[model samples]
Target: MTEHTGSYYAATVNKATDYPPLIGDQSADVCVIGAGFTGISTALHLAERGYDVQVVEANRVGWGASGRNGGQLIGGISGEQKVANHHKRDVEDLFGELRWAGHAIVRERIQTYAIDCDLKYGYLDVAIKKRHLREFEADCRRLEKSGFPHEFRMLSKSETSETIGTDAYLGALLNMGNGHLHPLNLCVGEARAAESLGASIYEQSPVLDIEKGHRAKVVTERGSVTADFVVIAGNAYHALERQLRGIMFPVKSFIIATEPLPENVVAQINPRDLAVCDPNFLLQYFRLSADKRLLFGARFNYFGEDPAVIRKSHRKKMARIYPQLADARIDYAWGGTIGVPINRVPQLGRISPNVFYCQGYSGHGVNVTHLAGQIMADVVAGTAERFDLFASVKPLVMPGAHLLWKPMVALGILYYQVKDRL
Candidate 1:
């Protein structure tokens, strides 16, 4: 099997762990499939609640999106406002409470587990158009009315340029509450935390199938895990169930890490070291690493895993934003697939009463996945209020999504690209 610790975050992981593959029949109170953030988060939550949990991963821990994400901890779920609009009630109270809950969970977990992932606070939601500025102003107003604890300010054009060293944006909404981190380390550290709490994790053990009933049995190549409930948290990399396969499209996002910049260059650009995301359907998000490298990311028409091509495409975009970085050497380039539902909301529901699944967070996986893990855990524990809020929104499944995912995703990207330009 390929080594999982080759990614940039992997190279700098706080700790290295090698767990054996599942080799025999095992049983637990819950069996989770896939060891990405969703699976690991769910397993960790259940284990913390004193449940016997066994996690089965196709690769090593954090090998999928969890290990490969941009690590921006922006709050709020995808399409939450639209979902709340459908309830015909005051969802402000419900969503307002849950909006920053994931952020709280992340901060508490980092402190409680002592996960060394270079966690920091500060982010900017930048605007490129007058409409974007208006929306950001509205967002700032809402946060102010809600008495947001963190420092949030609306930046003028000059302030925006000063903060980001880029005149590409018209203005920005800065929030000290949001931040970035080393995602893979957090995932691995959380898995370790779960392991310490008596949870069992098996790597290189892809789940072949799940036999569902009162007690679900997850069958791997070399072992089987029987549990009272089964949680499928694979997100976009999952292939175990046919029902979820065709329900969403896997869109590829790529990122490139430039060599650590000079102190003056770093000071000139991103002096505050805050994560920044543009407001566009096909967006670009970037931030500086603890080692002082500019990690830039974007979506493109490509889907292959060629690092050279990713570097070429993403470097050009990065240079467009900051021309001084045009000659910077790219140290790392990689891509990962994100499961995007048709309606842009996260998919959380049950294939069976004893089997629950949550996936398709669009690009907001980091924050939403943690909240989802909590919701999934609550669902298994017979708390369905928050679970139902998401599960009620059924996924819009395409006719041939599984068979034609590539073409479909390419078309969707093209559509979004056009929309972003307009």
Candidate 2:
């Protein structure tokens, strides 16, 4: 259960960060747990605002999904349209303003902190069926109607193949606003920025218990932190709290990074270097790393920490998309868990007035988590407009969600497989 780092992103992390574990009583305006994107982002936001903030992590910084995820910077929130349907307000007007807020934040953070995370521009939402093409068309129309600042266009079958070197997609919607980056470096760089702004961070300091009150006391094995407010940013990796444990199901997603290919192979595979994602319910997302290696990701049935099994499953899926890569050597294989709420909307609310929580971004964590951090900071400061928007939607908690996650996820995979086929 204990490993330093196995993914290619971890192997090449620009800087390694180490902080002393919590060992004595401490106090702060805010204390965040988990140390992933959500925790780091929130601490950064708070610290920048002149608030005293501290972050405690059970593992090293960016050790969870934040470091291991496919670096696709996709737009929009998952299941947002459904939530919009439930409201009387113009969903477009309300969410459109916030849709790209995370991207803007990410871009600014990279520039401000001088974080080199192999950031790139351009992405394609590819379609596997005529229905998916229709969806893409609708999305393009929406972007135009919303007066999107980015260049967005729909590609025909030939154009799609020319752009991605794959014939599996019927069509695609190209959005320059969406892009990719090295996620581990981004998270760590953001943590550095937060620290520079006076946020204290402790790694390998897992919270053992929380004593809730007007000011909560977060207890670790050897130390504790009392704070005006506590934010649980642990998401799927967290197991400390009973309320969080079984509310959201942990779904494992795997990825394989192939060894850098020949220049011609790279040219033939992804000429424009756009990140590509398929429209299947059980999705496949791929993009080129800065060093010109293909990073392919897919959802599979196997669970546990066996990298060999993960590599085999993901490699087969990669070959299916581009048979020319049947012999591509996989350089790294790893898996991470994503918190999937029953409604597919990210859960944001207060367990107590002084104890706030945010989790369950499904597979949309990269973009949405930043937005969530901002919303969380806003909530801590008494601005609840955006927070209420999400909190108003109740999470669908399944019985024994933590214990039955494996079987439930298998069922979901089968269901999405059928849906994708239809």
Candidate 3:
């Protein structure tokens, strides 16, 4: 079985899940691949809709990027502006509802399943540039126009410093709707909930290749699943399908968790207990876990899996923001891959009529994945409005991109780092 990385989330989960690996042929109404947020969320939605669903994972549930993300529950899809601009006709009236759809799903799931994932409902978008502040103002306006029910306010430079105990940001936009959580725990809880709804989840069941037919067959090493519909929901770690590759470039993001902070220290920084994110391509995101430890994450050019290197690299970056944490004891570090599309639009379409795929959320997987789960279920159940909206945006397929993902990501990081400086 593929073990989960030594992430802080894994270490402090509500409970460990030991799902059985797929060893025999199984039949279901729908077969989903990759037990991360997308697959598990899709399964949960399908099972809740009274569809028999089975999820197959190459590793432990949420073992990939879904388990190791920043856990910030930021709202809106990545590149929403670009999507709305390019497909204005298609998204004109419904963008507002679709923008925060996943947040609603997440809120409902957490409460319905009674999942204790340390879910909070506050976030800050700290701005480093004047342009970023402009974007924040526009975001605030959109929230107002939509009659959003969350408490949102902009913090001036001094207020930003006081709120986060940092002078790195010129200002910040606080949104009570977006927040952070224990993502692994959420994934596991959702998986358990799906199982409770009669959804079978098999761990360590790496898909070899899929056989497309009237009833699609998902082949694994030791077993297979034949279902009326097959959903490939793996985001960044998926490699079973040739067409899913290259269209999305994989980038590495790393995170480090500090030892529990003192109450006074916590009060000084993030007193509102809000998830914080900066405005840069190589951005820094942070939040205080329920236990009070500061979890900091960023995207770096480095791609290797060395916890010490990750911790050291991020300790320096974190100290730059919160210098008081210069000597903060690092308790855990880990990294995962994010699938980014060339146009930054999430690609949701089909490998075949019966075989569906949903991926390329960029960095908005936490919220968007649940939204995607809903859309995937809708598509399978003969509703395609939302799916068609995304599918209409042509995915840019870069040939041989996956084969050269690492170097390409390194170059992209270098380019974005320079742009961020400018």
Q: Relative to the true structure, how large is the alpha-carbon lDDT of every model?
A: 0.89, 0.89, 0.91
Model 2 has an lDDT value of 0.89
Instruction: Report the C-alpha lDDT of model 3 over 216-311, residue by residue, as the tens digit.
Output: 999998999999999998888888789998999888999999999999999999898999999898999999989999999999989788999999
* Candidate 1 Cα outliers beyond 4 Å, as residue runs: none
Cα lDDT for residue 380, candidate 1: 86
Which whole-number lDDT from 0 to 100 does residue 150 have in model 1?
94
lDDT of 2 at 17: 81
- Residue 391 of model 1 has an lDDT of 87
How close to the true structure is residue 311 of candidate 2, measured as C-alpha lDDT? 82
- Mind giving the per-residue lDDT tens digits that candidate 1 earns over 104-196? 888888999999999989999999889999999988998998899999999999999999898989999999989999999999999999999
- Candidate 3 lDDT: 0.91
Candidate 2: Cα lDDT at 262: 90
Show pairs that collide, candidate 1.
none
* Residue 421 lDDT in candidate 2: 91
Better model by lDDT, 2 or 3? 3
**What is the Cα-based lDDT of residue 49 in candidate 2?**
86
Clashes (candidate 2)? 0
Candidate achieving the largest lDDT: 3
TM-score of candidate 1 on Cα atoms, chains taken together: 0.98
